[model samples]
Target: MNLSDSRRASIAWLFLCFAWGTGFVAAREGVKYAPPFLFAGLRVLGAGLLLLVICLLTKAKLPNRRQLATLLTMGAVIEGFTNICIAFAVFYLTSGMLSLMLATTPFWMVGIESLKPQGDRLSSRHTVGLAIGFTGMVGLLAPKLIGVSYNSHLLMGCLVMQGACVSISFGSLYVRHQRLGVAPFMGAAWQMISAGVIVVLVGTLRGEWVRWHFTPQVAKPFFYLLLIPSMLGYSCYVYCLPRIPLALFSLHRYINTVVTFLLGWLILGEKFGVGECFAVVVIFTGVFLVQNSSFTVSKKEPSS
Candidate 1:
């Protein structure tokens, strides 16, 4: 690549990291002023609309009925379940805690996958890693469970986020199973828009509309989320995916967690105590072993 092209790619990578890393913090801040469901519903809907516009401009192919049906179902699990739970979860949990909790998703995915008759058999090390991950997860929530300054709402939020992780696992597996060969961007756009509509309708029924207010405090983070992570960051992902290895691309997940934890501490003043530190190390160590044992090299997905 030429110098100018290389410079633009570098810029995109930096912004992509910044945008994705701070996403949970933005959601947490936004929902403080607006109802959680409405905040999340509108955020996804706006991003979906903008992404659809870009896809159309680029002449991405549309899905037929069967593909549309599969996409919509994936959306129900991915967007509908995950987004709703996340909105409510962040209402109670610190964004950093939420991010750390999300790092356990691969554990849940393996458990879910093992239920299938054709599932990959796990090694002794893999089984031990899963156990360790679960132990760390329980430790992370031990204060609430043990009633050491426990909060019922915070416990509930943590549970809800777990539910979201399950949703994400199932949704990812479902997408892999379908193997529909729909253009990635086009498929994501349709799924997002469909799920956005469903969530917004449900939120309206819950009277979240009455709770929503367009104050300056909310508008900044709300728009930042819609424009940055959901739209531009994803655009950057599409751009970078082909140019980089899949393993390198997936490192964004780890980067996002560390960046989010640090930013939550700096910007939101979220506590990171001795217990949290110990739990974080154990959880990631478990994750490392689990991911390493489970690793199957994947080719970079085509952006279009």
Candidate 2:
């Protein structure tokens, strides 16, 4: 790529990182004031609608009817579960903690890939990285398992959040493996739309509206989520992927992980104790090893 192309890619990547990192902060704040499902529901729903409008105006290549079911299922699993898990878990877990846990997604992706018949082989470095990361994860979970610092509710949220990560990993792998003949933006539009509708219907069924009362205070975070993370963040990601290399794009998780931790501490005043300090160091070490282990890696996830 030329100098101008490189500059544009860097800017897009930074914006994508900012959008992803701040998204957790926004979600945590929104859930605190609004109904978890509804707040999440509206954010994704609005983003999906906007993307759909863009696709229509641009005359973008869209997925055919036969592909809708698969795309929608992928969306419901990836975005749908991600939104629901974050919404429910924020009541118990801080956004910083959420980001810390989620940094293990690469590990989950590896595990899922291992189960596939035609999965690629991993080097010794990859195994070592996985082991180290698992050690850090066990430390993180020890409090909940031994009932030292967390209660049943907190533990349950952790499990649910992890489950959502697994769901996202599996869905992402399936979509990439199938090589669905759809444009990235078009497929993503349907995925987000389906996910939003499902969450809204579930929220409505649960009478979450009764508990939700929209106010100006909630609007700030909600709008940020709708426009910045859900919409613009994704736009940057898809734009950057074809322009940049996968290795560079992989830096996104690390950057956003730190961003979430720093913002959570600075803005939300979430606690950052010795344990958090240790986890950050240890987990990143493992992730770095895994990422640089010379193993073939997939592209960035379509979901934010």
Candidate 3:
């Protein structure tokens, strides 16, 4: 790519990262006017519908029966369950802290993948990375877990966020293993729609409808989540994937975490102190080690 193209891509990538980073705050603000599940469902559903239109305009191929089924299942786990957990988590944890917990997703993904019969065996480096990652987690939650702060609700929120991570990790593994032939955008659209339907149904059954309000405060953040993070951020990711290396693209994870931390502190008045900074460093260091390690086994490798 030329200098101008590179510069534009860099700017777009940073914008996407910022959008995702601020999404936590948007959701937090949105739920003040709507139930968490309902808000999540609407945001994702709006994005899905918009993307579906884009897919049609681009002539993206629709998934076949088997692919559709797989996508739906993925959506149920990743978007439905995962997003509900996240929405609930934000009620108890600050967006900055929640982002830190969510950053452990790569660790969960590695652990989950290792459980499969044909999955990668844990190498010494992987083991070390896991240990360090767990230590960082413990450090981050030490106050609550050790009865110093001892808020059961907060503890539950942390667990729920981790559950969300695990759910997404499993869904990712399924996608990796299946290697469906559908276009990425098409698959994402279908998954969002399926997840939206399920969550919206659950929210309605739980009587969130009676609680729903469409005031300006909620509407603003809701639209921001739909358009900025879910739609534009994802579209930018897809656009940049071919232009950048995977490792470089993955750096956005850490960048987003930092962005969330800053935004939460400045805008939401969320706490950020020495302890939190240390934990973030340790956790991100552990993730870096894991990513750079050669312990990951390819799916094509033969299992003995």
Candidate 4:
């Protein structure tokens, strides 16, 4: 709580938030050139290799069989499914919509936790807030629903994107409970390696590998993915997760939606309407309320 320590923490958090916010943009940019699966595979594989090297240099121990299984599952959920689903969703929905939908992840976490015998109980306020948040999301997305004939293609994309967030929430809960007994970097390295391999294998089987071609325009974003979001951003996440409060970290999701929307608007020329604006404010406010409801009486006090 000393001034210097608090200052260091604040700086670290700022860096992490910036990285997380920009990471979505990096992924979106990378997918434009490379096949989605290929893009995800390469970024994760490169990050995995980098972290693996670091682990070896530090003499970190490898996981046991049980831990390995858990790591693989986490990989599938967090990196594998999350990447593929969001990529597919990107084809149909704007990044802003996708990000906004994905921000419901924390509510999913709360719902899951409530199912456990020893888990945190949800207040009635939290439940009401969750409903309001979902309502706002539907409002925000209603425009996309009009005039566009429904096809399995678009429906599947929406399903995949929502599934990705659910899977990530499930995987995060597993990590929170399992206690893998390794450093964040070590755990993250294994997860990325496993997920990357899976993505590459699936992509290849789906004929994505042969379809991938490298050119200057595409290559630039690919390299940025490998270095910035994949390596640095994920490292920051893994490092910060255990240190920050769970509810506090959830705010990052909200921030990410705003960041993605603004970036998409400025950089990609995605359009935003009055409905979208109102929906964003309402949705994010509800999310904040649901997430912070338990400690509301304290006003300025941070939620643990």
Per-residue alpha-carbon lDDT of model 4 for 1-304, expressed as tens digits?
5677555555666666666666566667767778878777877788898988989899988888888788877887677877767756766766776777777777787778777666677888888878888888777655665566435554566677778878888887876777778667878888888888878877788889777988776788777767776787776666556666777766777777778888888887888888789988888877887778772222244579
- 1-304, model 2: which lDDT tens digit per residue? 9999899988999999888998888888887788889888878888998998999899987777789888898788788988788777888777877877677777787777866666756768889999998888777667656745657776877777887779778876776669778888888889899899888877998899998888988999989888998888999998899898787888898889889989999999987788767867788888878876675554444676
Provide the overall lDDT of each model, using Cα atoms, as 2-decimal numbers. Answer: 0.81, 0.83, 0.85, 0.75
**How many pairs of residues collide in each model?**
0, 0, 0, 0
* Candidate that scores best on lDDT: 3
Candidate 3, 1-304: lDDT as tens digits:
9898888788888887898899897777777778988898988988998999999999999999999998888887788898888877889988877777888888988888788877886777878888898888888888767756778887999899999889888887776768789998998898899888878888898899989998888889988999999999998887777777778878888988899989988888888899878988999888877766775675765679
| Ten contiguous residues minimizing lDDT sum, candidate 1 | 292-301
Which parts of model 3 are misplaced by more than 4 Å? 1-5, 296-304
- Pull out the clashing pairs in model 4: none
The TM-score measured for candidate 1 stands at 0.89
- In model 2, which regions exceed 4 Å deviation? 143-150, 296-304
Q: Cα lDDT for residue 117, model 4? A: 61
Best of the two (1, 3) by lDDT: 3
> What does the lDDT read for residue 167 in candidate 4?
87
TM-score of 3: 0.93
Pick the winner on lDDT between candidates 1 and 4: 1
Residue 83, model 2: lDDT of 75
